[model samples]
Target chain A: MGVRGIEIKKKTTMENQLHIPTVAELMAKGESPEILFWVGCAGSFDERAQRITRDICKILAHVGLRYAILGTEENCTGDPAKRAGNEFLFQMQAMMNIEILNGYEIKKIVTACPHCFNTLKNEYPSLGGNYEVIHHTQLIQSLIDEGKLRPDDGHIFKGKKITYHDPCYLGRANDVYDAPREILESLDVQLTELKRCRSNGLCCGAGGAQMFKEPEKGNKDVNIERIEDVIESNAEIVAAACPFCMTMLRDGVKVKEKEQEIQVLDIAEITARANGL
Target chain B: MVSQFIFLGILTIALVLFGRNAKKIYNNIKLGKPTNRTDRKSERLKQMLLVAFGQKKMFKRPFPAILHALVYVGFCIINIEMLEIVIDGLFGTHRAFAFLGSFYSFLIYSFEWLALGVLLSCAVFLIRRNLGHIYRFQGRELTKWPKTDANLILIAEILLMSAFLTMNAADYKLQQIGAEHYIQAGAFPVSQYLTALLTDTQASLIFVERFCWWFHIIGVLAFLNYLPLSKHLHIMLAFPNTYFSNLEPKGKFKNIDSVTAEVKAMLDPSLPPPSGEVARFGVKDVQDLTWKNLLDAYTCTECGRCTAACPANITGKLLSPRKIMMDTRDRLEEVGNNRDKAGNIQDDGKSLIDNYITREEIWACTSCNACVEQCPVNIDPLQIIMGLRQYAVMEESQAPASINAMFSNMENNGAPWKYAQADRANWANPE
Candidate 1:
């Protein structure tokens, strides 16, 4: 039936796990889950994101933090598809992810993608899945707090007037605007702000799957507008918290032919560098 | 005496009865969920000073909007004159607040002129709606509610306008005979002209003025009681609602679980837990909705502004953001009726997509947040749509088959498009 005829009522494909006694289960599970990592679309699909997440996993192992992957490997949280008019695909993807983390006795989940963090942590409970979802910026911030990662502050990218592009997902969608800024501060990169930063950050032409489909009529692709704002501000470097925003803004920089004048970096990559990785 | 009593009786019945029902339903829906911080009183007071009094949204459209602000100011200041008409009828003393007689009289003329101009501007609005050929694709939302009963509103508008002119002519005659003229010779000269019409008969002018004043005041009261049921409801709902508009950007989807979990914890202390059987998530239906949704539903003026902005509607998609609001209003009426009668709303539940709005329409929403931004009154259709989607997906398990499949694939393969679980970190390779 190609998923069309499969009734959720009959076979119970997507379970409304909302009514389950989870706090009691958590009491049995221990103080915290073994792992809490955000699995983003890029973490699942993009080669660079996969590498970054795998690197993160290796770092966690090296640091000896108790954690488990929500999936043994990784999965897309269906945010991309849902944002597009393809609700069917988004729901299909979301319902398919039966994250048997409960069976594995896992609680906390840390994620690399802001998109996944938003979708899993924000949008998922409607489909009856709830978990304590944390992003890498937050996890890294906690790690820094625990005195695990210390910056040498001699990075080559230092002393540049760098402006940060708050990704719509991370900044506006999740309100995680400050952690990335704190990480950027740790690197000693000169921080600049755009007029439309944080909650008012413009969408990169990627969200709602506009990255896949064409950007419809607007003054410009929201990302291009943002990148131009950065260029107009004359900042030398632009860093972002989300990979999707990084890729989209980087593409925008390329399209504008200002790549020589500007650089785009992710929070994790910057954090990894600051720690002298 | 009886007519005055009857006129007021109608207003009293409408406000005390119908308005009470609206208020009751409003309060009940408000009681559906606790409102956290939607209406910040200080924020509203600040917006009243900065935006509403400053005429900010009007400033966006410029000239016509300036004229609109004049009418708005006129509406505010001259409401006292309406009270005078009622008081004079019920107790016979007029000019209740005539301390600066010339200035107050000038205000009367100015407010009257502004009312005339407001109607002219409303005519422009009617023309834009009818002939502008805008809002084409928002399909039914743009076309349906706005289309129906617009002519009646227009006709009543014209009638009220003509009444204003006629009433002014009669009152000018009265003021000419009874008191000082209310206008400059260069500006109006109507009172000067009224001398020729009134041919030294004070008694006749008094009767004419009394008749016009009565009709004018009665017409206004009729308009007021009618306001709650008409497109003009925006007149009242717009100002208050705009002042209470959501301060956050329309595109920002705040985490719903954190808030709902707090609510659930407060509501039921010994509740078992969140698992797979229920949603600690977005609203699944109107019944599942919070108070703001109901307010947003009631607040819709069916102006089709959101429909006009909807890209999907522009692309000939069946969805109209404005129509969803109109339908919400329509549904609220039905639901309220059913609830009042204590009838169980049948769960042979007609699929919302099929019966209320189209599935294609529901799917067509891009969530671009334009509708929310452009809705001068600050209605958020995106969250409402998400809530409805939540209900269908969570409780009903009724969704587009493709989404179900995507969920399956996500469960098994860890991607919307099924991909190898091992391949998840495949992208993290060195470029």
Candidate 2:
């Protein structure tokens, strides 16, 4: 169980528990999935982020969407390398990934991480890797819009005050502001906005390779400042879309000693919980 | 005849000096590496029109936007009156464009209104900068010269607008008295209030009118010459800056073609080795930056909007995007001066990185694009920061140990962690 007492449902108990297929498995079956679910490095490894990954999988299963994961073949999108100024390593990684993606004939991708989403959608095109890429929030919003998924009216999150933190790569970097909020609205939660939301949204201090190391000297940590906004919004729950933001904000809530009061959950997690998946 | 000669001489000298300064700036920008911003011609023009001509981005901060728009529009429209001033100065003609009759009156009437707008707007700006305690105006980068430069331009605008109105008032009095060569061809709506300040006598009125005319013309010329020296260069540079804006998703940093070729050769053994003098990986100095980056440096308004919005600066980090642009421009100016003195760029032992901008500032950026988003002229400071980082990592291999650790992790394990690639799918059926 996570800090918020949101039980991490085991694989055996998940409803309609269809086995997720990797791209290689689908390819071996002489078929192609409709979209590729790019579970980024954090989603695969980070404890907190892995829970969101499971919820996303549950949503895809509930909706019966034909999605395939890159699995062992997926590489880091080299976002941190490119941003940290290691263009050589970034290009090398980009070339290898582009080769594999092209080989797989992948058309569209949905990622839970904005860093991977941003790189694959925006930066990869110039490196001979182009595909229709979308964040998981966009995919979730569309699923709700298409009437394929619905939040249970009497779900636990009903009327709960939740604020969405805009991931820099998702919001300002790509301008996908409304999709997450629209998803929240459908979940029947009170969507309170931070003072700095949308294009003016503050970073969770985990961007631009900053997550890999200690931040440069400053008066206070950037995440602490962002947590102040979350506190100021007075929302009981903070909804985030990016794995990096999840880690940073979760750490911030603990630092502020508000873990007992405020629960930091990804939009995917909230949606999954609201739908009783 | 003597006054006409003197006027021509002053105009010639001012134009010549301004021309030289413009050439120097052009050459300094030319020193930068070139990137293609010329592809999207129509889109560029449209952007220039909307962002620069239309003042669209300025309106993001409504209060200052309204005030800035007043000064901008007022000053621009008033410059139309400069045609008459220039013609009047040349060939020693009085009211040279006065032959248009009532239309001239309408033009003068509108100019008077705009002049008054400019005068008041500049006064308000001065107070806001000095007394309003606006956070955007105060920063470590704004100490001394930048501060004085801003106040000087505001004060100059106020003086120029006052001179314009005073000149009009004295001219109106001359017209009322029906003095020689005073044709009474223009309207005196706003300046009509100032007419009482001048004596009714023709001798005194003529002296006052002539004094103001000379002051207005001389002041305009001096200001023109001063544009190259102050942050006021944005008044002219913003147009081109907005035009050459990166017209792509803000997150899409340009891929280094040199690195691409090297990577291609490495991946494909069949390909021949890349043959060329290796270029520097990223921007270490002004010359290593793209010409568009250099132009962005020149186009900075020093408004501090970028810094005000920066997450790093907000968190009290050393990074300030405005300071990055300012430092770039300052180093460029130093380089330009060196080239002028030596007839070529002499090694100054100082570079943009580690000298003007420190590693602390560069490392503090999260590349959030808040700075880039807040820039009214579409200046991209994050590009320069990345460029500096590129130099540090590729050309110098000086990236922080943690970043290097992440890099090696990605290189070996295919992720930025120590976990094995074979275990990547373990999340699917976690224990």
Candidate 3:
């Protein structure tokens, strides 16, 4: 049978699904799957994201948690589908995933992508998929609290002012504003903020499947508006918690040709740096 | 003598037409669910009542909104005056309203001047429509019309308002010269100036008043009768549209389940939903739509403001949101008129999107909140379009090709991006 019509219809089949991304899916997954780190979409597909996931995986192993990567075997959690108004497809995809996660007996999921984090923690339960979802920044903060992640003073590149960009999914979508900043503060107190933050942070031009389709008709993309805010601060390094934000910000830096002038790093990578593997 | 009867006939016709339309509106509203914003009982009632009469959003955009308010209120009070004039003509004694003496007289004078302002502005509007760019969107040519609808309505207003002015001037003249002393004498400033001009012939002020009153009354009736058939039909439709507008401020859209009785029958014959082979997903086209939707298209005033705010339209996309509404109206009228002739609407085997609204217009919306928000009259072009999209995607299996792959992948892989569903919560895992 052709599965095209099944997309939005699957939503009706699976009633009681809130159709929102859940935050509960960010915790650790698997009993003995060697590595169980949530390779959220940004980390699962992109080489750079995989590298960051691998780096965080490597860093966390030293901190005493066994982790495995979810790579090509990864299934989308339907965030983009819902955002794109492909609700039928979103529900179906979410169901297939709930089965997969249930088979894995996943208890928790940690994601670098807040879209994945928000979907997993906040939305997955509506589809009967339940898992504690946490962001890598939260993990890093937890690791620090547990004394497993200790950053040396030298991990700090002194005299360099840095600002953190809050991804909409992380900040506005899940209210994970403080965790990323706290991780950054453990590294640098220069914690300057862009004018718009938290609930009102500008979208990185990648949310709601805008990454797949064309951008809306506007003089500039939403991400460019966000990066302009970043560049205006003139901070040496612009740190973010979401891979989508990193890509958009970096794209902006390239479009404006401010690449050599600015550095965009995930908060986990920056925090991992202080741990000095 | 005949002028008085003519005025009576005109008033009777206007009342009948307006009464029929008003009954239809009231019945539709009765059939309609309470679609207003989510609030407690009193709050919703207040909002609806206020929105209908308060002109809350009109004030958001200054000059046009204020000018519209003048027309709206002027149109309202003038209805009373029109009927009253007809009454006076058929039966004689013209009674002074609460405004005959002091405060109301000032209001009458000022409102008359303001109505003049609306008339002049409407003239500018007519010129603008004639000279404005020919924006072509969704196959409906929203134009600086060869016969502009807004301008025609404005012209009707000008006719009605001019009649009012002439009648008012004539009333002041007659009453000043003929009425028993103080009241008419005081209110008739314009007539006092005309006293010198009328010295020669006793021009019989009562006859003058009746004639002027007939002009005012019949002129208004002519405008009213022209309203439904004209573009200005939106004036009547806009209030109820606002009243029934979706008040859902929630960011989350309703993601309904797709398993209807038909699909259930197709699957496990036992536990099917009661309806057989029902549309489980969403709307397919015009007839599959809710009646409120039908009303929405019919009510559009073709103001290109929706076009202006539409991200798709602004970005050079083929979607003119206003045209979507217009197309719906045209299609509804076409289908409705033909529904009886064809015996069965589907017998003709014509799809609304193909024969009515185009596929290009369907694909253009980014679902941005602009059109819904910017509509001064509370038209939700996005939802109506989404309803059509529902039909195209779910019922017809006619979604855009780009989203086709995405939808396919989601069905097989459980995610738009085709990631492992099991890995969804993989991020919550620690190293």
The model with the greatest TM-score is: 2
Candidate 3 has a TM-score of 0.67
lDDT of 1: 0.60
B155 in model 1: Cα distance from truth in Å? 4.8
Candidate 3 residue-wise lDDT, B1-431, digit = tens: 67556656766778898787556444433332223343465655665566657767556457667667777777776566555455566764454454456766675666566557667777766665567554422224554551566656777777766655655665566554565521462243343354454423335554555565566666666677766555567767776666566554312344454532233344445764565454535554566555666667766777666776554565455777888777666666556546546554444566457776776676666554456555666677776666666666766777656677777766665445666556544433333
Question: What is the lDDT, from 0 to 100, of the residue A169 in candidate 3?
Answer: 67
Interface RMSD over true interface Cα atoms for each candidate = 8.4, 0.8, 6.3
**lDDT agreement with native, every candidate:** 0.60, 0.91, 0.62
| Prediction 3 global C-alpha lDDT | 0.62
**Two-way lDDT contest, 2 vs 3, winner:** 2
Best by DockQ: 2
Report the lDDT tens digits of candidate 3 across residue range A14-95.
3232121222332433144433566666675565565466557656566666555444346777777665555566565566
Candidate 2 stretches with Cα past 4 Å from truth are: A1-12, A15-18
> What DockQ does model 3 achieve?
0.12
Candidate 1, B1-431: lDDT as tens digits = 67667656755764576576557556545534555645577887776566556666545447646656765675666576676666656654455445566776676667566666766766776676577766432254545546655656666655665555555565565555555432321123333344465434656665666666666776676666666566566666665666666665344454445434443444456964445544334453455566666667777766565766565655455667877777666665666666657755544464334567555556556565656755656677776676666555654676566666656665567665567777654433323
